[model samples]
Target: MEFDHVLSVRCSVRRYTEEPVSEEDIQKIVKAGEEVPVGHFDFKNYAIAAITDKKVLRLLAEENQALSGRGDPIYGAPLLLLIMNTPEAREDSIKLNAGIMAENMHLKAVDLGLGSICIYSFIRTLNREEGYGKYFQALHLPEGLKPAMAVAVGHTPMVQRERRFVARIPTFRIDGKE
Candidate 1:
């Protein structure tokens, strides 16, 4: 798909079908995440976990539900691509790099005709709940790494359609004359 079309149709897909995203597409999405630029050339400080296990997803969703009081925080997506950061990763770098990675993967999912939603509450819950070490450990991340951000991906029953552009964010142009 063209980049403009992908951007036009890209959206937060909260609902997903039972169908699992194929391994091929999953790898493609992960590749997209891996290819994004990281600040300070500290790529080694970040990692992505492609989670598909039903039990693990359920446990994460349960934690999200408990934290946010939502019925299903993940919307039943079959896969979650979680971005993790090590303790040595700077706060600014973590925020920017993780967001870039998630957006890349999310856009790639849209290009592949899959549904995806950038997830943060789950990560927040995982990081906040020190007692929930078991849930964090379930991810099997390398030592010292913690969940920073995530994007849930899977097949969706909804159809994607091009959307007209809208000015959602305020913008201002500055010139020397100003």
Candidate 2:
């Protein structure tokens, strides 16, 4: 699918089916984000964790559920991808890079006939409360990699599309020339 079409329709989907994302689709989704132009696409720029484990999801969801009061299992998502950056990066560069990658991944997933959502909550707290900070290092990421954002992917109850505007903003003549 073309990039424009994907962007036009892609939005945060709240609900998903019981199905799981195929390995091929997961690769494609991550590949699109990896293609995003980041300053350090090198070894330590960002780490993408595509989690298929419910136990891990539940652990993270504990954070969100406490904050939002909704424990829908992250919208029943099968794949939870978290993007991380290290403290060595530019201030907030970790989150900045993850956001760019998140957008790219959202559009790509839409093009692949799937849906994705960007989620952020309780991760930092979890890192502090728990010892999950080591999770990034366990992935072999350079020490100090901080998780910035997460995206949930799966088949949704509805395929979102760009809404057709029913009305347009009225144009006004500002200058006498008009």
Candidate 3:
């Protein structure tokens, strides 16, 4: 399919079927993420935590709810791709790099006839939430790495709402007149 068509086909799928995502597809998703552009310098700093355990998902949901006051429902997807930003890079670079990786994963999932949704609403509260940060620490993941973003991925279980399009207008005024 054309890239434009693929872009249109992709959407944030909030409802996932019970069908377990295949390991092959999972590998593709992860490889796609790894393929996206990280900055030219110090690009080897990003990592991920791919999770499918329902119990841990439940725990994460509760923590997210407690921190943000609204449950960040994962929609029971079989995988959660957690982007980690290692401290080796500058802070801004880390976020931008992670975003590139995420877009790659999203588009790759779309290309593979899969679905995904990015969750970014509760990060400010997450760092200070009781036991949340500690959980990461206890995991003995590399030091100086932090969770930047997460995406849930799975098969579509139902049809979503009608497609909505919003056109983009140039923000700058031409010669400060137009």
The candidate that achieves the highest lDDT relative to the unseen native structure: 1
- Compared with the true structure, model 3 gives a TM-score of 0.82
- Model 3 scores a C-alpha lDDT of 0.74
lDDT (CA) per prediction = 0.88, 0.74, 0.74
Return whichever of 2 and 3 wins on TM-score: 3
How far out, in Å, is residue 143 in model 3? 2.7
* lDDT of model 3 at position 166: 78
TM-score, every prediction: 0.93, 0.78, 0.82
Total clashes for model 1: 0
Model 2 TM-score relative to the real fold = 0.78
lDDT at 3, model 2: 69
lDDT string for model 2 (53-153, tens) is 76666656665566457675367788888887766666646667778888888878899999788876545554654445333334454556677777889
Candidate with top TM-score is: 1
Write the residue-wise lDDT of candidate 3 on 47-114 in tens digits: 87777767666676777677667765577787888888766777768768877778888887777787
Ranking by lDDT: 1, 2, 3
